[model samples]
Target: MPPKPSKPMMCNRKALPVAAKLKLIRKLEKGTSVAKLCEEYGVAQYCVNATASKSGKGLPRKHMKTARETGLDAAVLKWYVQERSVGINVHGVEIMSAANRLVHM
Candidate 1:
């Protein structure tokens, strides 16, 4: 008997560029069918649907830091500047230890 056909391997698809996503959204708005767009663009139906739903918003921007994190960043920057001004060779490990101490105090 002939061997059974093997299933194809699946791989992750690359994310579409903002321009491509915008084009897809425009086409969708112009009454293009989802299935037709999928075939034309070589993308999954979900990609088209998501792009249409989001209306070109794409991914959200990075979230804002909390007050504590903002304060920590400022304190670290100040300490780093001061260390450099005083001619002290500061390493990443030392910076991390300083942050730990600041957090504990």
Candidate 2:
């Protein structure tokens, strides 16, 4: 098994930038899975969503016109679509809003 994450690793705030977070959320809106993002960056679900919420925008991978969109990679996008088509539903707005609320607490 992998080593347990240290406190710092568990609490990193530099996973992504404000603009990048916005891009990530928007990418998610186009059927991306939050779990993929969490695993990809070793970030908690709340972190991914809260960052996006603070940016006031969701990053839609489909809307991406270049290869520089951080964290919303092609493999992750494919997994996102596959997971979405398999009946797994992740309510984006509600999830993000709740994450935001929890972050502010």
Candidate 3:
């Protein structure tokens, strides 16, 4: 019988350098979105925020608005509610029925 293979090792690395963290903070301050920052930095927002948070730092304040507050079209919302519903076989009919009701409302 072949010898058993050892389990792979797991390692968690430390966060980025202070300078890099500051640079990201500056970019965030300039109105960059957290999602965009995460994509550009090749790191998760949680990681970035965790590092920043450790330094008692915060992302820039921006006037944020939700879709509904920004005048989302009723028809568009209705369509979205319809199209974005769960598609499980068990819930297919229920989802469609709910969507239809919203569309008509």
| Candidates in descending TM-score order | 1, 3, 2
Model 2: per-residue lDDT, tens digit, 8-72?
55665556766666667776777678898777666888787776665555454245467563444
Off by over 4 Å in 2: 1-11, 56-105
Q: Total clashing residue pairs per candidate?
A: 0, 9, 0
Residue pairs with backbone overlap in model 3:
none
TM-score of every candidate relative to the true structure: 0.50, 0.36, 0.38
Q: Residues 1-105, candidate 3, lDDT per residue (tens digit)? A: 999998554234446777888888888778888888776666776777776666667654445765543333565555556566754333566555665675576
The predictions' CA RMSDs to the true structure, in order, are: 6.3, 22.5, 14.1
Summing lDDT over every window of 10 consecutive residues in candidate 3, give the lowest-scoring window.
68-77
lDDT of 1 at 95: 98
Which whole-number lDDT from 0 to 100 does residue 43 have in model 2?
A: 82
Q: What is the lDDT of residue 7 in candidate 3?
A: 53
